[model samples]
Target: MSGHGVALRVVACGKTFADGTRALAPVTLDVGRGETAVLLGPSGCGKTTLLRIIAGLETPDPGGRVLFGDSDVTGVPIERRNVGMVFQSYALFPNMNVADNIGYGLKVRGVGEAERKARVAALVALTGIEGLERRRIDQLSGGQRQRVALARAVAVQPSVLLLDEPLTALDAALRERLRGELNRLLRTLGITTIYVTHDQAEAMALGDRIVVMREGAIAQIGTPRAVYFAPENRFVAEFVGAANLIEAACNGATLALPGGTLPVADGALHGPATAMIRPEAIKIVPAENASLIGLVDSVSFLGDRQRVLISAAATKVITADVPNAIALAAGDRVGLSVEPAAIRLLPGDTT
Candidate 1:
């Protein structure tokens, strides 16, 4: 489908409700043409609010501005903004068949009946729902319904697509399958898209760039690799992935952990920092090396890897992912060593 190409620019965007609750604060973001940007954060962190502002469903505060290409769209209404939205509920019309549902927007725009039918047919084929075009909403499975909703959203050939936790209702296996399909479809369509989700895994898997939002503000924005491996702060590190944060005190050149003294990277010897390490970054060894002695508290198998929970200090449990072949039961003593370069230091105030 062909339509007007557009890029989005959100400049100093802020959102505050009449009840005096500030949903988002002074946020600025730019989505390049045909790029997919994912807004990821916990609930009530303003990711959804920011998305609404972009969709023109929620107006930004006076100082903020939303631009679609060169036109300022902050004051535009939702329908006027050539954007399509997919909600968590899939929001299908129970009374309409898949073809009618997909063609509704085009019909409303006064397009010829023949053109609408042709467009809907192409969308049904694109979404792999040709036979199901006549099916009612209640007759479709969750995944099928989701595809219909997506097809409907794209039927209008929107310049920007906004999705709010669209796959959160699906089961784990189905969610994984559809996530891959959605990523491929979005890339093929090449529409500038903004997706909002609380699932960090989904964000990491789908986003060309992940924007990490904190309470009412942006914490960091980067590619999935940079956001996961080089988080700017402790909140981003812990929120994006499972980070084993060890308490450490910096002393010029080295960091003192409860287990042992870990050498700090050059110019990173800041005072009172937490050493962040991924569970997979910690290796299990039989001999005592530069390691921490811990007693295994619990072990659980997760298909390919075993999650070993070890206790190094009182009430402090460290998680490590060991290969399933390395059998170890609870109460077994082990040594855990991490690569020096894998350590990341964040301020102690990070929570």
Candidate 2:
């Protein structure tokens, strides 16, 4: 679904806390109007800091700039920025009822009682919380409380929506369910959204484009399929999914693995390189065919499939995902084969 019609831009944005910790580097990015862009990375990777800067909760460094549409908002205050934010903790007023909490912003802006009630009622209906108007904050379920928070944020019709790990406080099942619902709701509203989350699955499922960060810098940005299946670097490959990087000698059109040689696709890197392969890409067969041969060291059931860990030559541990019905045990000899097209040769020092 498309994002909101307003573009949010961050140019050369950087942040350093008062305690001398540089939380963000000089990073630049753009979130298109009505596109849900997800900032994903490990902890302390500056994703949250960047979001806070855009929200005007924290100031950017000297060379940083924040803008909405064509207006430069680098010096704008939080209240005047017209941005909606959903926090990880549902920051509802414990003393207020659901309706009052949802209509708090309108009241602060001096909206008349009749107009406030109508707006809050419409938002409650839009968020599917029709009958819980009188419920207290403590009386609602976690998911319901989150919906209230979302309704309250969007009640003002802010220009941009910023979400900071909004579903992380819920249980796994609830988180998954809410993610699907939130995706649908956001798409229906067509609001420009910047979602910050460390959960790769959530980022992949909801984002139109996933921005992978590392050490306060953008590592890679692309569609979920592009980031997962065709990573540009070893870090992106390993971070986005489980990858097996095998040291190999590339000679124009062939790569030398530990046990066998495989033909490389056109434009494959030459000389010493790392061959990146996914666990599921390697198939366990009866005989080796331009791939390695190894003995099964461990086998574990992963619900829909059985993951077999094999010990190949050169002390390499390769994992192969087979069907659950495939009967396999430790000490079994198996040959591994990977399609040439699936073999990604990356140039780097893998040591």
Candidate 3:
């Protein structure tokens, strides 16, 4: 952990609108020094609203407190909080060139011209915007403008960096390319950062710990693998990744399915149970040697792997990810094999 990076804590933080609509419920979270925490969810899930509260752009309702390391900053305003922010809109000055935009913060701080120029040059180099320093904001491409925005935010070297969908403005290819670059840059900076985005792929790519939000509340918070493979509930399972769900009455210790019974650990789950399985966990084999039989409804070649949609496997269509080399066509009867450990059982009905 970098000494310059600060840990953040929020205690019982929440918000409500003027019309009395609660945009966020009381929630608490922590981000360690030099850690990157991603707030991920759909629109209106309160991820952005929470980011605003932490950035000091919005105040929480009473009885809430925000802390940066040992300092309580709930009453602090945005500028005094020493937080750097990046947004999706590429909020750069239209008339300013890249160097001016990057050095604007240092210049505002009354730094010497020599130091300001040195800092701006370093940032321009660090962000790979070297030759574009003299280019006006309008002359830069979307990705270049985004890089400039990041450089501007980080030039101040604040304790915390808050990014709100910073890559959302680019097209899919550019977004993905910039996302990779941003991930590398963030790792190099090692600043305690909080990122907001609805894209699960971005969350998985950049987040050290993902805070999955839904309906203004946190659904689950954990490492990417933990949240995706060992979700606490059905919503977390489906939201983090594609999940194949099976509703079955547990006959003793086993779950009865379409073609055969799936053996589970003793005392694993009883009565009516829901089993969540990832598409990649199912292995395609000869129908005679597998647990379930299904007819392939469709097959999509997804470059590295093929996704085959199986009909009449469980309650819904069972999608399987197999290697592209595995020859399978639509309407072919196939057997799906799932490891006992891969099947995550959820007890009871929807709680």
Give the top-scoring candidate (TM-score).
3
Q: Which stretches of candidate 2 lie over 4 Å from their true place?
A: 1-5, 288-290, 313-315, 349-351
The lDDT of model 2 is: 0.86
lDDT of 1 at 199: 97
| Model 1 C-alpha lDDT per residue in residues 136-254, reported as the tens digit of each score | 89999999999999998888888799999999999999999999999988888888899999999999999999999999899999999999888888889989989887776778677
TM-score quality measure for candidate 2: 0.93
Per-model CA lDDT versus the true structure: 0.86, 0.86, 0.89
RMSD values for the candidates in order, in angstroms, are 1.9, 2.1, 1.6
Which residue ranges in model 3 land beyond 4 Å of their true spot? 1-3, 347-351
Which pairs, if any, clash in model 1? none
Badly placed stretches (over 4 Å) of model 1 are: 2-5, 313-315
For model 3, residues 111-192, the per-residue Cα lDDT tens digits are: 8999999999999988898899889888999999999999999988888999999989899999999999999988999999
Task: Evaluate residue 157 in candidate 1 and report its C-alpha lDDT on the 0 to 100 scale.
Answer: 84
C-alpha-based local distance difference test score of model 3: 0.89
TM-score of each: 0.94, 0.93, 0.96
Between prediction 1 and prediction 2, the one with superior TM-score is 1
